[model samples]
Target chain A: MNFVEKKILEEGRVEGEDILKVDSFLNHQIDVEFLNEIGKRFKELFKDQKVDKILTVEASGIAIACICAQYFNVPVVFAKKMDSKNLDKETYESEVYSFTKAKHYTIKISKRYLGRGENVLFIDDFLANGRAALGIKNIVDQAGANLVGIGIVIEKGFQEGRAILDDLGINLHSLAIIEKMEKGKISFKSL
Target chain B: MNFVEKKILEEGRVEGEDILKVDSFLNHQIDVEFLNEIGKRFKELFKDQKVDKILTVEASGIAIACICAQYFNVPVVFAKKMDSKNLDKETYESEVYSFTKAKHYTIKISKRYLGRGENVLFIDDFLANGRAALGIKNIVDQAGANLVGIGIVIEKGFQEGRAILDDLGINLHSLAIIEKMEKGKISFKSL
Candidate 1:
């Protein structure tokens, strides 16, 4: 097993039939050193791609994207999940359905940040249904920017997220992929 | 003038009479190298304090907190602005009123992450009315954690945030304090 898989096995918790809570390290309580290692892994994984900027959705995605941007030596632009008075009037927006929240919301990126023909790498903490990735891809398309690749810290391989992205020919690299979760036990895909 | 003040003058925009937008480099589009500089500056300012964990509100604060946590060699625990299904039931929550969003919301941190007597340093991008900082302080107190200091990237000096924090005897450090913003011009506190 790799470092991320080892961390997941050691620290990850199984919440429900579907929920795997890794909040202790990945999302809620961030381990900077571990995230740095994850960033380095991602850099090595996508070493060939030209990443002009790293893009992600707000809240959970911000930390990983910022840390990963250091490896790429590029700026990071995050899509805001809610409307705010401070955001610019002109923006590129996409509709996203969140299974966790059980609702659909708009994610926006300001026009001032994303430039045409720029290469963007979308990074996030989880890949569940791939709806959020599609949402980010739509916004990248709207901005006329290139969506070079998508980097995920964890992927639910049992779900249809990977299949959806694969159909679209998206270059995806996930550190750990959980193939099954049953009776509070987790197993990983042995790719 | 410091690096933050210089960058604010060059890229920040004054909206109406109050809002100062530094989206070009700070919030919306993050400059990772610039954030490293910010992280270094914050580390130098709070070198004396014992920071076990860095705390902040979610979304905007996550990037700055994560980047700053690298300098301190600690973990970052951000309070979630919205309730997630994945968040634990046992949490330390505080109610905060948002001036920009014009609503009240609850910020929560899991009881599992923050321990009693842990020394935490709060970090954020902007310190306006200080409601967010106050809310974070309340959570820290509820957890019996020591809030040693607050590190702000920019402080709205004309606002009441600093005074409010000062009344509580909070040790606050701001890289740049905008004393005045009028007619698209910003002046920093002399310090």
Candidate 2:
């Protein structure tokens, strides 16, 4: 978490008061080595939880989730945002509203992937409004899978995402939490 | 490669004549351990090539590329198919025609991630019509990067993807090439 916070401060570019652009190392151009460390940290945090699968949404979350899946030694199932002809008709779907894009998109996973009584760990790149978090939780619930844990690489602690997940009694772990981001300045939630 | 082949034979489902669904391992629900074998094999195949980066498209390709990036000890940059508020406006964009979905979409990558003279290796889950391959190649060309090689997990030999990539004089390596898929029966091209 120290390294991640340091990396964010050193390389993260703040746009306006909300956006943290970490495309250089975290999202677009992935630093696999750094993610491996994050993955290790997630594994350490949830060592007691039996994670059968790592669930996430496509695009940004895929890299973080896949990297973490290595540490969990489990399969990663990312909910598809795009409509693929090959995706099964029988799916557990959830809608997530993107505040940035100002649009709602459906995230779906084949029902066959998640089984009853399976423990699924939700992993993602960022948690802000908790829309994606809630959407993934919806799918996990539909499949009757136990939501073992939620691992986030970065969390905007100022946002309501944490409170929402906590209200659902979801055990959530975030590597880096930005307590404040204003006027090109960012503050972290101290341990 | 044997394990990959066995995985395809076991978990891969053929829908209609063109689609081979390997979502269980390759795409949707990723088998991390099995993909690690693929990562190693890709490294072995391109051992002589000095790969500076592993380039791929979003979603499905991210997992394999990220896993493979470990063996190459390089970063992986995936082209974003969807627009995002966080994505830099200055991007190298390409149009890819999705034959499966019957639509065209633009894939973009921030200009900062790719450099002018870096050696890049393109990795993906499947290669069929070669639109995605050509689209990615276009981005690499725009970045003025050298594409050292293109490694595909599965190639539909009956399609034009291989021909298109080969026409570009690209050094292509496919772990498995399906020679034919008819009546739900699939045949592979013997290496």
Candidate 3:
């Protein structure tokens, strides 16, 4: 978390008061070494839980979830944001509202991948309004699977995402939590 | 490669005449162990090449490229399928015609990540029409980067993807090449 926070301070660009773009290393261009560290951290946090599958919503979440899945020794099931012809017809779908994109999109996962009574850990690159996380959790619930915990690379703590998931009683862990972004500067929550 | 071939024969589903869905373990739901094998295989195939970065398209390709980047000990840069507000305005863009979706979409990669003279290896889940592959190649060319080779998880040999890339003089490698898919029976090319 220190390294992630340091990276954010050094490399993350704060556009306006609400957006933190980490495309240089985290999202668009991925640093496999850093991702491996993130994987190890997630594993350390949720070492007690039995994670059968790591769930995420594409397209940014796929890389983080897949890298973290390697540490868990579990497969990753990413919910597709757009309905693709390649996806199966029988799927567990959940509608999510994206504050960033300012639209509602359906996230879907094949019913065959997530079975009943399976333990799933949700992972994502950024947790803002917690819409994507909630949507993935909804899909996990619909599949009759247990939501073990949520792992986030960066959480916008100034936003209500953490509180929302906390109110739902979902165990959530974020590597770097940004407390505030003021005057193009990011402030992290002191652990 | 044998493990990948066996995985395809077991979990891959054939839909219609040309669609082979391997979402069970390849795209939608990713098997990290299998992906590790894929990474090793890709490394073995391109062991002699000097790969500086692993390039791939967003959504499905991100997972495989990230996994494969580990073996190459390089970073992964995935092209965005859509123009998100978060994406930088300065990008290397290419138009790709999706044969499955029957539409042309613009894929963008940030100009900062890909540098001039960087050695890149393109990786993807499937290679059919080779439009996406060519599109990425175009972006790499635009950046004045060197494309060492292209790595695909599955190649539809019946299609013209390989031929197009071959015509372009690109060294292409596919883990499992499906020679024919008839009545849901899949046949792979002999190694």
Interface RMSD of each: 0.8, 0.8, 0.6
Task: Tell me the TM-score that candidate 2 gets on chain A alone.
Answer: 0.98
Q: Compared with the true structure, what per-residue lDDT tens digits does model 3 show for residues B24-63?
A: 8888988889999999999999999999999999889999
Give the per-residue lDDT of model 1 (tens digit) for A34-102: 999989999999999999999999889999999999999999999999777899999999899999889
lDDT digits (tens) for residues A105-151 of candidate 3: 89898888999999999999999889988888888889999999999
**Each prediction's Cα lDDT score?**
0.93, 0.92, 0.92
Q: Considering only N, C-alpha and C atoms within 3 Å, which residue pairs clash in candidate 2?
A: none
Off by over 4 Å in 2: none
Give the C-alpha miss distance for residue B75 in model 3, angstroms. 0.5
Q: Score the docking of each candidate (DockQ).
A: 0.91, 0.91, 0.93
Chain B TM per candidate, please?
Answer: 0.98, 0.98, 0.98
Candidate 1 per-residue lDDT over residues B1-191, each given as its tens digit: 98999999988889999989989898899988999999999999999999999998888899999999999999999999876889999999999999878899999999999989999999999999999999999999999999999999999999999999999999999999999998988999975
Candidate 1 scores a chain A TM-score of: 0.98
lDDT of 2 by residue, B69-181 (tens): 99999999999987777899899999999998899999999999998999999999999999998998899999999999999999999999989888899999999999998
Q: What tens digits encode model 2's per-residue C-alpha lDDT throughout A17-113?
A: 8999999998899999999999999999999999899999998998888888888788999999988878999999998999879999999999989
